[model samples]
Target: MRRQPSMLYLRPFMPLIVGLSLGFTLCLVCLPLLEEGCTSEGSVDQVARLRKPNSVQETQDNPKPAKSGGKQPFRARYISTELGIREKLVVGVITSRETLDTVAVALNKTLAHYIHKLLYFTGTRNVKAPGGMYVVTHGDDRPVWEIAQTIRYINDHFHKDYDWTYLVTDNTYVQGERVTDIFDHISMNRDVYMGKRVPFRDMDGYYCKVGITEKDGTQAFSQACILPLCRGEDVCLFVCLFVTMETILDLQPDEWLGRCLHDVMGISCVGEAEGVDYHTYEFSSTTDPDNEDSQEFQKAHTVHPVVEPTDLYRLHRRFAHIELDLLYPPIQTLNPCFPAQIKNLSHKTPEGEAGLTWPIGINPPFKPQSRFDVLSWDYFTETHLYTCPDGAPKCELQGVDRQDVDDIITTSVQRLNDKYQKQGLTFEHVRLLNGYRRFDPTRGMEYELDLLVGETGPDNIRDVVTKRVKLLRPLSQVEIIPMPYVTETTRLYVILPVTVHDREQVAKFLDSYAQVVLDIHENSALTVVFIYDPLDAQNIQEEDVFGMLKSMITYYERKYPNAKIPWISIKTDVPTQLKIMDIISKKHPVDALFLLVTVTDELTIEFLNRCRMNTIAGWQAFFPIHFAQYSPELIYDTKPYPATVEFGKEFGHFDVHAFDEACFYNSDYMSTRTELQKQRKENEDVSETYNLYEMFLKHSNLHVFRAVEPDLRQRYMPRTCNPHLSEDLYHSCLVSQAEGLASKEQLAKLIFEHDNEIKSQAENVVKS
Candidate 1:
């Protein structure tokens, strides 16, 4: 029985024995090969042999002893030999169908050079993948949620470890080398986020409801309170990271990310922190072209709101180099190249050319050099002396040659029509008339033209005409009157309260007032209604003051014949003043009224021009002028004053305040003046002058505009002093003008100094 079982039953064990025998034989045969360092295919030895040498391999078997007090060698693994910090960065750009192509071009031009791995997540698969671009399709179109989902998807699908993940919008432009440098000291394992930060409370009130429920069962922010907190999409993505992944973000308050993070999440960003340098730029839409050359721009790691392709290209060209120190030197040490000053010289007769000269024995006429000088003339002139040939009283022609005057008028009308057309304005009809003041025989018989334009609405056509007319006839002047058949021009009737002290103390201001008339004449169809207050007429007799003022008006009228001048005398009595204003308003249906309490203060040409432009563009019903008041000592200083010397400091350092001299009353507001006066009379405790503007502001909706530019300190001077005309009025007026001029001179000097410094620096840099 044992013999019969051995032959056939041992078949399974025989195969196992053969396999063991074969393995034993193979090991014996490979022993010699293993000793010789020969490795077989698909073996662990083969894999080890194929791998490149370690970057920090020991040259000898034994380690070298360290010198006493010497620093220890870093044992950290090198991820890449060529790309240090860049090797760890993985940038993910969030874009949509609308901006996918634009973002692709921008990334390909800028960040694509240094990024270890670049991914673009878009809403749809409508885009064709570019040559080296990794595009991922997402179901969501919203950038806020999509950014979060994209990061999560990358982390899940991609098994490779990435030290940093940068999430940015399509408009974000990154300087890759700058970014690497910024994050060089930062640990890769830390949950670091970098971007601009904004406060939640500073955002618009509508986004105050968005918030998360804390673990304590109370909502961090209720639904109703999210509106004011919620920020723009540019900011929301940064906040999403903290919600989705417990990320510690380094927020820059100056950047879009910080603005969004703080605005939406009530998070305060640090100006400086570990692992982050706040060097991001949220470039303003109105950024000056010169800002691109600034050190801040050179050092910027990321610049946001850069949607334009040209801007992306420019940034790329600027930051492509590796010379960080040379490119981004400290601004304090670097001298900026100042722009060359272009001197605007007045027109002059060419050398050896015959010019017009005053005829012998012909008086040049009485020209008032000072406000105190009274010209012997009348405000109202005879109509027959300057009437048009067509018998229209409003039309006047002044020239020795009638045909030549007619030809000039015709040319001016045509030119005006063309000018209006070029400015995108259309006129229903235009009529030209000739004007004659006292003619200068030597100046080829002086003449002027008046244009009557009919349009559908109020427009800045008058401004255009005034500018062009001056070019056409530098010796003459042109007036533009918007007719009733055209759109109604809003008339600003200015009421100036002039005291006798004002006449003596602020004579320079009176001279400056003539400029206001010129501004109104050139820019708008308006009138000035000066109301002289005789109560404080102590410096000069009331009659003499009135006569002097009349003379001044007559002088300006003759000089600017097209200008309309209407004025009346009023007692200091408020009731009497109100009656006179009412009468004036009835006679001329004014669209607005201004009460100039500070009669010495002059309305600048810039302010008047702005008012005209705003009105033409579409003015509000109740518009107020925001003005400033400057100190007399500061204004009149002959020595250069520092820019740091705060303006309007004497008036509580406020740029705007309750200044009656700065108030403007619209048509609706002018109607309420009677009620305001009544209220003032009933409540004697209220200041009549101060309460007038305040009452209108409180009762009605106001649309205010800053009439004066803060940079122009001369414009801030009030026409009259606080207590009528103060004793220091003249000193202040003169000093302020001198200070303005001195400031300009000082600025020029500073520019020259800086230019010299820049030249020296350039020479040093070259020598080095």
Candidate 2:
């Protein structure tokens, strides 16, 4: 080089010299044409045109050299240029009638230009399928049939001109520009398909676990020529196309298409063993693009399973302005490129067979342990000293030791003291009582405490008093037990009228009803009163009526020896019935009063329990009375009134009326009924006597608890309201004369039927 530059050293400059000479020759060729057709001004325009074409063509065909005067090799430059640009591709969308209204509409607006055709399949022939879309009818509901038909339709209609066929559900979301950018590195002329990839092992595990297997205990598939067809519709579709193609690009391994190809079609996806230029994404059903993760959004080419129509529109607006240059770094700042190593691939033997072992030093998600630390306490022997309200020893002791109990009590007291101290108040002496513990069936464990509160501290300022403190525990750790008997104060008075024709029927009704009354035990008291017509007493004999009523009390007393029975019988007419009611009200006030016109219905234990619990909860007014047909056997065959009767309407007439006979009134409410009856008689338009009483109660603003039990209604038949019967006769007269009184066996069967109904109802309440 020091001596002189050789020919080889100057060779690189020859191409520039040759390019300049070519440009000069092009100008020379145009000089004759320019001179013959132009003046001096026009000749400059002709020369400019000749230089511009040559310069532009050369710039487009060649790559600029680096500052070091070295140009990229010819083959490398050609490959890089080809990878950077791609021809416009045609895309086809497959949808169905079910999704056409939601997903198809979104696709039409978002990817209209890219869409070659929108193919919709439906089973119905009269759908009046939309115009400008291809519609296919095949009576099958399976997705496989629709997919297969769509492929055939595209091939036949488009003449194999499409670059890519994106098979997607109506719910999938895609960006047309992003999809185009992903294909830039891909060669469309080659046999290539890109989608999410799924592994074979994962798919096989899911199918085997779900019991989708064959007689040989392996995953099952339908027969399709020599190759077995996969169960998944998407898997089958891509595989069918793969059989005719060379290279299949699996985009996402976790998604359906990739899973199917690997598991069902026995295809090894590309990305699992190599790095890919394009990115695959799956947006969760719960994701919203307005608050999406920025890093995740930037990496994705296609986001799948976006079923929401609003999200599809939003996704389109986000990437509509994104240019391909923004997605990659600037060329001047770019580092030398290197191929990435394969990720998450299984180990292979020297012979290329997949090995059973994974990479060393890998850890499981969690550490294995035999036992876990839970909040537990040590039980003491003294815990067994507690007794139930009945003085019966509790079966089990779920309590902590003395030290722990003392610590809990001390901590609780300290917290209370600290809170009051902030308000310039403090407790004096605090002491645990004789260590007495009691078990409340409903409230769980409790302890008796003795404490003194005064400003003088503990210096003879106050006396120590006892108080009950509920033993506290986590609700999850508590076990609840049903109380053996009701404990709340509940009283019910049943008023009934007995007549000559129905004296025996009334006795039977009282007999069965008393069984439910006795079940209430010491928690509640019941008084049953029988009213007899003085006129009917003359024919039936008063002693006989009294004897029948007394017999009912004797039967219940003997049956429930432990329960207290209180009952009385009085002789009265309609006018004097209210007077008798007043006398009984003063003698033994009740929580509720029930007027029984007929005793054809059975009462459930649950209803009786609810009555007691409601009373305890301060419900003192109306309790809902459900109605049923007069005949039990006809209940299912005949329809019931849809609603409670409105004011002044007869039963079964307007589908809304009071259940006069079955209604329960607060004892205080019943006491005010004498004045209501007086008001009713004073009104000039007294077409109906029964419903007027209900209207009076409604105006009083009394609280009404809806205790309508459908099961109870079936057993409790409605009072006979036949207009054919004499109005003067007691309502029970019709019931007594009515045939088909349920025998003891039938009554037992009714109780059994209600048992399951109540249990299921309780479970639903607890769950809710």
Candidate 3:
């Protein structure tokens, strides 16, 4: 009787009983709890979700927040890009033993550090080294590989990250053979600009045969017609970043050049604060009260690699490429990107029959360009240079000008000596401008290109020289910054601003763009990985930005069915303990996730690979870290979104939360992507949207606002004091009331108190 096993006999009937009773029992017990879990307050009432069906089969799974740690879940800014990114760009030092290697690592690391920060915020830098050599570039105009290097380094090393393509470089890439050569190649050829020569009565010594006739060949009034007929068009600007510890014993001048370019030379290039009478880094030397009070920022510059002890011609040589012609160069049709000019031809293809002249020419882009005079070989070749032949000296040959050589013989030495002679200098002063000769018949052209093989050609020399030629140094600490590449509206800002009249509404999808869009793996669509967003003023509370982001993401996955997606929302605001607390206060309104829970047992508390950390492919929810049991779909919330109480971690906490979705074909999501996009003339009658007045009205709902006081934060916490000390001060503060902790009206009242403080801070930061 005891062996009947408490209902063992019923166990025999258990199959049928379970078949009959379990559904009803679960429906009665589970349905009520789950329905209440989702519909409750302070949750991301995401898009499509489950309603109480008639039976247990439709019950929503509910997982509880892990009790181990006090952590606030994130409001995911939904970002998706189908990618297989290998998160490392091994920047090998390629240095000698321990010491130099350490220096290399430190310099590169410091460079990488500031570059990451600058790019994350401004998306720009003043100087960039796309390859081994340093380069000075406007943030917007940096070479593609340099931009990629910055993006990849940011993605791999920083807590907040970014990504680029395997090969998106246009100017240079792979650091192969020093891509700086490209600039040198472009600058080699030059125009022959002539100016009326001045008499050498004041300046004498440089020798040249001067025989001249007057304007009318009267009175014998002679002057050297100083015409600079430059032909170094193939020349370029290249440089070396000199690095050094002690030039006397250890560092060579060039090494110091390298080090300066590698780790320094950022702020020094421009005068501080526009016209501050101090060195760029002069704010330091605080304890050195006896130090000289500063005045008038000196141009930031490098002192090494001079042709003479006091001469800066080595740098000048590089600078000359740009300095040669303050006026824009004669545009050549071959240089496609340059603007059109009479010389840099306005059109490659001539417009329809422009007042036909005698000696009719074929329309350009054929043989012998239609623009230049056929009789004047020099004009045809030098001005409208195309895929055509203008024969003269070698009229026997193709496109050769025999008279061109004769013109060169007289013009060559005189042109070289002209500009230099005015300054009492001569041909020897020019490093690469050795004498030239006619192009031999052996090669295909009229000019034999000679690269003085003693030393290899320079790379990024112009940029190197540009930044170095202007250093305001000898005072203050140094910092390097990255060049800005992405636009403010386009970066993570793409998804940050969207106010749903109700978070309690079912769900709304938001879209984000990448700094550089990588190709989608399978479909015609792109795999755009969003790297960051400014901290949402609203997300500071409940960080369920992590959650709201989930809905937008569910939307993208649905809309772009064939494209795979991965995304993370990086809150750019630094945080404090109170701020972190504000985030945790509001738990998930509904936390249904596509989690691979099996990995939970092994997660190291604060490791970077945790489910919520930022990366090119979102957080690293690796195999074991994301899963718990061997459950196939171990989710506890409804589909498309989550339950408020279900979004937290069970055994481990993370900087981010992982959400998985197979959600597709969502009509709701599509509507939002095109929300602001106008469809047609018929819709023109629709009322205007995005008005400041409406924004003011919408923002009147104070409960959702988050504020910050800039003056207080900046004065207290700056890594400039001791970068490693602690970032406690930089953290954000959440002043709003906690979810479930306060009524909406109560929260609104508290929010308004800080609104003024926030508004003033925003204004001050802009002013500062």
Candidate 4:
């Protein structure tokens, strides 16, 4: 069985962290500075709140990045302890490139259609590299004035609270036809469509969502996830384009580009691209300051469809608006021309030289391999050593079937590294990825893994492993503790064989499984078991395997309590009921846990080793989501799906319509607050009116520091809510992954596939 991709990107905000206790989450209907402080009653956020809001309350002058030298219309405000005030400015990761890459191409095409035709984003094209990608307008065209107009218009009509948003573009290896047309049309007539979905539909709302993880650069799709919670006319979209700028002696990245366009820029695009005219706000691009300490508040916009328009808006602003420096206006204003003439570390700031990668968007935090990963895989395969298929990457081992992956990888690296040893830069950063074998189930499985710590050669098992381990992290500060929550309750299937009995007498054997559920540790809510009657089974009680499972669970529990082995039994030897095993597997999507007794005279069992392997892989893929929310325990029954026949004096059934207007009309203030309470629940802060953060809660025990509390499930669901999570994460994670693929120098396809497969499995289960 192929490993399933993760539902890690499935972020359902309405069901996971909607807390009665927490507050201060950004209304991510867009992205950035993902801090969730304890805001006032109106909102609830889960992340850390970064900074205070602008001091000037009447900050009406909005800086038109497109126009250059002007004040912005709105100043972001929130509750801040640093200022001892309510109106503070919070920061969080908006949609990022890595976040965008996971989105499938079909969704990308659909969204491209949405934006291109409406906005005239122009011909969507792709620039590909071995480890990078870029998707943007075919020819050279920027979105400055059009985005400016978009920003101004949105402020004038929709919302005045936030004037800044990120516009994330999609990552596409292939851009289908009609993408540009749809994008262009949307740009001109954004108001034609309601929201991302219709206003009153039972669908996803327009919100910018990002999955934040402290796990740095470990290539796993599950590490970062996202969902959409933003809607807008302006977008700070960050585009990821391939980097092929070796001519400039700059290998910035393989494929990436930061294509920004705010609502202001989109409006500008309308004029320049489509000749649409709107009243231009009398705004200069100068940001005035009275010597407040201001730092470059970095807000990233990843390009992808199904994202908060915030990133695209940013892209619009960055390119079409003004020089990038002004965007980082300090609260304590610093001259863009710093005392020493400010320049970025990469020397690519506004003053720095622009190059082929200028349009490419490869930002910092180059994912250095982690220490855990570096030492996690050691050469520990003592199983078999053999050669691969004839003429296929020729190997020199013994048996053809027994292959040593380490040998193959080692040889490849040695040959390649030897050829490039003359290069000056130390080849210390890169190494081999271990954990590359499947243990045989024939013998008791003892899985052991080790990360390469360096010392590899081209002809060796690996080209290189970590030789010099960097001790950079502050060991004193880094502490870890595991908090176990009530995870999934186990399911049990019993296999009781028929002895000296015909098929009709099988009910007597089936009745015992019901008794088993009642007999096992009842007080523990962590366990649930189901009994199955197999259609193709023939065996007696002693000759059967049902009794062996009881021993396995009993033995495994004592051995690996953490494994949480659940149980299920299959009763075989019945003539017709034997095929039920396939039905149960199909419906529950449960890995083949039940033992199928093949016939009455003898015992034939398909142990389902592959299913077990995939099941375990699925467990890891959704490790975050598994316990992140509540999942109803699914059980297979020997009996058919029983339909409840309700006898009522008056027959009643409600057919729900999409976007029902009646629900809102009947809602009272209390009901509205309740609904808002579910949607925008800010955690405890410092005050009743503005802040709700409780110091104790803010300084939570690190062990319980789930970004989205595992116990909390109301506002947005966790990666596990495949029903909700799959839909959201699928849309969000894949989009972000697309961005990552386009931008990240060396994209990790392994991580993407793992995450995608997990979600696919869950989705197939849901669909089936």
Task: Tell me the tens digit of each residue's lDDT in model 3 across 91-114.
Answer: 211121222223323333333432
Residue 161 Cα positional deviation in candidate 2, in Å, after optimal superposition: 80
Better candidate number, 3 or 4, judged by lDDT: 4
How many residue pairs clash in all the candidates, one count each?
33, 13, 96, 248
Residue 368 of model 2, lDDT score: 28
Segments in model 3 whose C-alpha atoms lie over 4 Å from true places: 1-13, 19-23, 40-768
Model 4's alpha-carbon lDDT is 0.27
- Each candidate structure's TM-score, on Cα atoms with residue i matched to residue i, is 0.26, 0.26, 0.16, 0.22
Query: Which digits, one per residue and each the tens of the lDDT, describe model 1 over residues 218-301?
Result: 001111222333324434655555553323232221233334434555444433447456566656667543236767776676
- The regions of model 1 sitting more than 4 angstroms off are 1-491, 505-521, 525-543, 573-584, 590-598, 612-655, 662-666, 674-690, 701-768
lDDT of each: 0.48, 0.46, 0.26, 0.27
Instruction: Report the C-alpha lDDT of model 2 over 1-768, residue by residue, as the tens digit.
Output: 664567778789999999999999999999987865444444444455567755455546664432332333356356534565422344545555666667667766677555445455554445545434555666654444544454445445543334444444455566666565555545444333344433344344221111111100101111120122223545555554655332223222123333443455554334311234445555676676754756767666666666667788878756652443364346324632311112223234452323222222222112224456222222223334344434565534444445445544664455456545645545544555444443333333444344333342334354444433333321122424222233334455455544344455555555556555655443445455656667656755534656756766677678788765576566654423344455566665465444333444445566555555543212234344543433335223356633222221112111123343433444544545645656664654322333423433453444454455442432233334545323533453454434224444554677887898999999999999
| Model 4 C-alpha lDDT per residue in residues 1-768, reported as the tens digit of each score | 233333444445535566522443444432454333324222221111223345645345953223323333454365443343321111111112243334323333234322322111222234221112223232322232322233333334323222122232232111122222223333321321110111112222221121222111000000001011123222323211232345223211110011121121221112112332111111112322111122321211122222333333333333322323445457226663442332234365553544223112322212236764322212323243322344343344455323344444443444344445655222332343433332222221122233343444455444544331111111121224322222123232323322223333233222222232334432221121333345323443436434544554465457544444454444533212212323333433223233222111111111122112222211111001111111111111244522221222111111111000000001121232333345444773211211111111223221111121121111111111112222433354344323322223223444576699999999999999
Query: Candidate 4 — which residues are off by over 4 angstroms?
Result: 1-78, 81-163, 172-768
What are the C-alpha RMSDs, in order, of all predicted structures? 34.7, 31.0, 38.2, 32.7
Give Cα distance to truth, residue 368, candidate 4, Å.
26
